[model samples]
Target: MFHYNATNLPLQGAPGSLGRPAKGAAKKPPPRRRRVTLYGLTFSLPLLAWQLLFFLAPLAFLVALSFWTVRNFQMRPDFDLVNWATVYSNPVFWQTYLRTLVLAVGAAALTSLLAFPCAYAIAFKLSEGARRWATFLMVIPFFTSYLVRVYSWQIFLSDHGIINALLGRVGLGPVPMLNNTFGTMVGYLTLAFPLVVLLQLFSLVFVDRRLIEAAHNMGARRLRTILEVVVPSARVGLVIAALFCFILTFGDFVSPLYLGGGNPPTLSIMITDTTKAGQQWPRAAVIALTMIATLLAAAFGAVGYAYKGRAR
Candidate 1:
C-alpha cells in the first residue's frame, strides 16, 4: 500500500518501501583536495640525507670558507675580508677576466655563424635521409670527450701534424692554427658549434615551407627569400642556437686552460691559483660566485634574445 500524496514522492528513509532505496546500493562521497608531501622515514630519509650531505653541507661550508683568511697556506676558520679584497685589488684578475670574456664572445659568435648556415642547409636543402645522416655527423663529436676532441687540434696544428704536412705537400708553408688566441677561439668554436646546430634543427622543423613559396611568388629572390621568408620562420631556432652558443662558450673552463695556456691566463686558471693559499675555500668561493653571476646574466640575455627573435 501507498500513502504518498500527488504533490511529491516519499521522503528519503521515511518508512515503508516507497521511501527506501534498494539494498546493496553504493554511494560516492565528494572528491577530496589532495596535498603533496614526502612520506615515510624509509622512502624520504635517503633523499634528505643526500640533500644535507651533498648539497646543503658543502654549500654552507663554501659560504663560511669564503669569509675565512689564509696565512702561510694554512686555512684559519676566523672570518675575514682579505680574500675578497685581494681578488678585487689584483690588476691581473681584471686582465684575465676581460681576456676570457673576449674569447668567450668570439666563440659564441663563431658558433652562431657556423650553426646558422649548417642548420639552414639541414632544414631546407637536404633530403630526409641525408638530413638524418648530416645531423648525426654534426653531433657525433659530442659523444667523444671534449678534452680528446680539443686535443686533436694540437695534433692537426702541430708542426709535424696533418695540416702542416698537407701544406708541405702543397709546397706552401704551414699556416699557424694552434697556440695563442686564434687557436683558443678555434677550440671554442669546434666545441660549441655542433650543440648550436642541434638546437636550431629542432626549431627548423617547425618552419612552414609555404611561407617561403609565398615570398617567392611575391617577387622575392633567393637572398630575399632567405632574409624575408626563411629567416622570419626560423628566427626562434636561430635565437635558441645563439643562446646555447653563448652559455656554453662563456661557461667553458677547459678549452682555454689546455689550448690558451697560462700565458694568456683565462679567468678559470686565475681564479683557482689566486684564491688558494693554504685554505682554498674563500677566494675559490668568490670566483665560483662570480662565474655563477655571469652565467645568470647570460641566461637573462638569452631570454631577451628569444623574445626579440619571436617578435621579428
Candidate 2:
C-alpha cells in the first residue's frame, strides 16, 4: 500500500533537468566541404601548362608578329600598322574572305543535312550487332591518310575516271566533276560526313524512348515526332557536327587547291600567297589571326544556340 509513483518523485540530477542535455553542452560541428584541393591541382596543372606552352604562347607570338615590320624579307620586331592597313585595304583579300566564308557555311549545312538520315537509321533501325558493324565501317575511313584519300578520289572523280567510264557505258558520257566546286564539296563530305553521322548516332541513341513513344501515342506521325522530339533532342550533336565541318572546311588548303583547282582561293591559300610573296610573314599572320577570330566567333555562337535554356 506504500508504492511511490515515478512521476511525483523528485529528480536526483541537475536542477530543472528532465533527462535532457545541459544547455551549455558542446554541439557537434558540421562537416567541412573541400571545393578545390592540392590533389586536383596536381592533375590539372600539367594540362594547364601544356595549353599555356602550345596554344597561348604561340597565339601571343602570332599577334606580336602581325604588328611587326617586314624589311628585306626579314621579320623585324618593330610595331607598325602597315601589315594591318595593307591586308584590310586589299580587295582580293576581302573577296577571298567572302568566298571562304560562304564555302564553310555551305559545307556545314550540306554535311549536317546529308548525315541525318544515315545517323537515324543507325540509331533506331539497326540491331545492336548491325549498329556496331556500321560504326566500325565508319571508323575505317579515319584509318587511311586523309591526303591519300583525297588523292584516291582523283581516280574516281577526274574526267574519264571510273564514274565517267560507267556513265559512258550507259550512253550518258562523261561529266566534269573535278577542278570545281563540286569536287571541293565531295572532298569536304569525305572529311566530315562519317564524323557527323557518328556524332548524330551517339546523341540519338541516348534520347528518351518513352518521349518518342508518347508522341506516337498522341497520334503524331513518325516524321512529325522525329521533327518535333528527336531533332530537338539531338540538336546539340547536330549543331556541333556542323560546326566541326565548318572549321575543317574553312581552314582546308588541300581540297580547294587540288580538287577545286584553287580557282577561288580560300583564306588558307591567301596566307600561303602572302607568305610566298616576298615572305610577308607579318601579313600572313594577320590573315591567320583573322581566320582564328572568325572560327572563335562561329564556335561561340553555335555553342550558345545549341545549349540555350539548358541547365548548368
Candidate 3:
C-alpha cells in the first residue's frame, strides 16, 4: 500500500486537486433560476393594452374636453372653468344629485334588510335543491335585458296596469307609478332586490354551519343565532353588496328615464341630456368622471373594511 502524508490534504497536490477528480476542465454549477419572461409578459400585455387604449386614453380625452371651449361649428381649446361653475351653480342638478344619493343609499339598505331574511331561509331552512332554484331565479333577471326588465316594470306598475288594478280591487287607491320619483325608486328597488338577496345568500351559505349550531346549543334564539353566528361571518359580503347596489342605483339611467319626469331629472337623466340635447359633452364628461370617482371610493372603502375585518 502506498503511504501518503496527509496534513492538509492538498499539500502535495495542486490547489483544489486533493479529493477532486483529475480533470481537463471544471464542472459548471447548475444554472441559476431565470424568471420565465414569456409567461409574465404574455399574462400582462393584453390587460395593459386594454387599460391603456380603452380606459386611460379615453379618460385623458374626457378630462381635456371638460376644460376647452366649444365653438359654433367645432370645439376649441383652452382650460376654462365655466363647466365646473355651471355644474356647481345649478340647483336642479344639485337637488337631483342629492335625491339620487338618498334613494341609492336607502334602496341599498332596504334591499339588504329584505335580503337578510331570504339569505337566512336559504342558508338555514331551505333544502339544497330549493336553494339552488331560488338562486337561479335571482340570477335569471340578469339574463334578460335589464332595460327591458325595467320597461316591463313600467308596464306593470302603471296606474291602469295589473298591479294597480289588482290593488284597486282590494280597495287600495291607484298607485301613481309612471313618471314619478316614487316610481323610479320602485323600479330601482325591484331590480336591486334580487341582487342583494343573491349576494347575502351566497355569503350566508359560505358560513360555517357548526358555529350556528353552537349558538343554538348555547340557547340563542333563531334571530340571535343569526346575529351572533351568521352575520359576523358574512359582514364582508354585506359590505360589498351594499357598494354594488349604491353604484348601480346612482348610475342607472333606464329606471330613471322610464320613471322620472322628463323635466325634473335625476343625475343619470342630466348626464344623458347634457350629451344628447345640450351637446355639452364636456359637462357630461365631468359628471361621468365624478360618478366614477364616487363609485371607486365606495368600492375601495368597502374592500378596505373587509380586509381590515379579516385581519382582525
Candidate 4:
C-alpha cells in the first residue's frame, strides 16, 4: 500500500505549473466594470450637456446680468447696486410679489383639496382598469396646447362665455370671472389639478393597505385612520406637489399676462414687461433672482420636511 500525503500532491500538478491559478493569489479584475462605467457616462453625457447649455449657462448669465447696469436701457456689463436698490425700494414690486405669492399658494391649496378625493377614489375604490381609464381621462386635457387651453378658459369665463351664458339661462346676470385674480386662480387650478391628482394618486396607491386595515382592526375610525396613517405616509408626495405648483405659479408669466388684464399684474408679468417691453433688463434680472431665491428656499424647506418625516 502506498502512503500518499495530500501535501505531496503538488508533485503531480503544482499550482501555476499546469496553467492553473495559485490558490492564494489575487485575481486580476475584469475590464468589464470599467466598460460599464464608460457606458453609463456615454448615456448620461447628453443630459449633462443639455443642462449645462440650456439651464446652467442661462442661469449664470441671468445672475451676472442682475449685478450689471442698464445705461439708457442698453444692458452694460459693469457692476452696480442701483438695480438691487430699485427693486428693494419699489412698493410696486413688493406688492406684485405678495400678490403673486398669495395667488400661487391659493391655487396650490385648492388643487390639493380637489385632487385628494379624486386620488383616493382612484387609488382605493376603483379597479385597476378603471383607475387607468380615469387617469387617462384626467390627462386628456394636457394633449391640447397649454396656451390654447388657457385661452379657452379666457373664453369660458368671459362675460358672454359658456359659464355666464349658462347662468343667464337661469335668470342670473353675467358674473365677472375674466381678466382678474379670480380668473387667474381658476386657470392655475385647471392646469395644476391634474398634476396634483397624479402625484397624490401615486402616493395613495403605494401605501400599504395592510397598515390601514391594521389601524382599523385596532378600532381606529375611518377619518382617523386616514389622518394618522395615510396622510403621514403620503407627506412626501404632498410636499412635492405643493412645491412644484408654487414654483410654477410663482414664475408663470403667460397666464398672468393673458388673464390678469393688467389691473394687478403678477411679479412674473412685471418681470417680463420690465425686461422686454420697458427694456429694464437690470431690474428684471433682479426680480428674476428674487423669484429664483424664493423658489429655492421653498424647495429646501420641502426637502427638509421630507427628510425629517423620513427620519421619524
> TM-score for all predictions?
0.79, 0.84, 0.83, 0.85
List residue ranges in candidate 1 displaced over 4 A. Answer: 1-32, 37-61, 272-278, 309-312
Superposed on all Cα atoms, model 2 deviates from the true structure by an RMSD in Å of: 12.2
lDDT of 4 by residue, 1-312 (tens): 222345766444423354355446555333322243544567778998999999999999988888887767677787888889989999988998899889888877877888888898899999999999988987887565677888888778889899999999999979898788877877787677788888888888989999999999999999899899998888888778877777777788767777667568888888778867866887898998999899888899987886684654
Better of 1 and 2 by lDDT: 2
Q: Which candidate order results from sorting by lDDT in descending order?
A: 2, 4, 3, 1
CA lDDT, every model vs. true structure: 0.73, 0.87, 0.77, 0.80
Query: Better model by TM-score, 1 or 3?
Result: 3
Clashing pairs in 2: none
Instruction: Please give, for residues 1-312, the per-residue lDDT of candidate 1 as tens digits.
Output: 223243553333332344444556534321222422333355657998999999999877877877887788777887788877877798877777787777777777788877777888898889999999988897788777888888888888777789889999989867766666767777787778888888878788788888888888898899999888777677767776776776776667667766665477776766666654435767877776667678788778767766773544
RMSD values, in order shown: 10.1, 12.2, 10.8, 9.5
Clashing pairs in 3: none
Highest-scoring model, lDDT: 2
Error of 1 at 265 (Å): 1.0
- Candidate 1 has its poorest 10 consecutive residues by lDDT at 28-37
Q: Which parts of model 3 are misplaced by more than 4 Å?
A: 1-43
Tell me the lDDT of model 4 at 37. Answer: 50
Report RMSD for candidate 1.
10.1
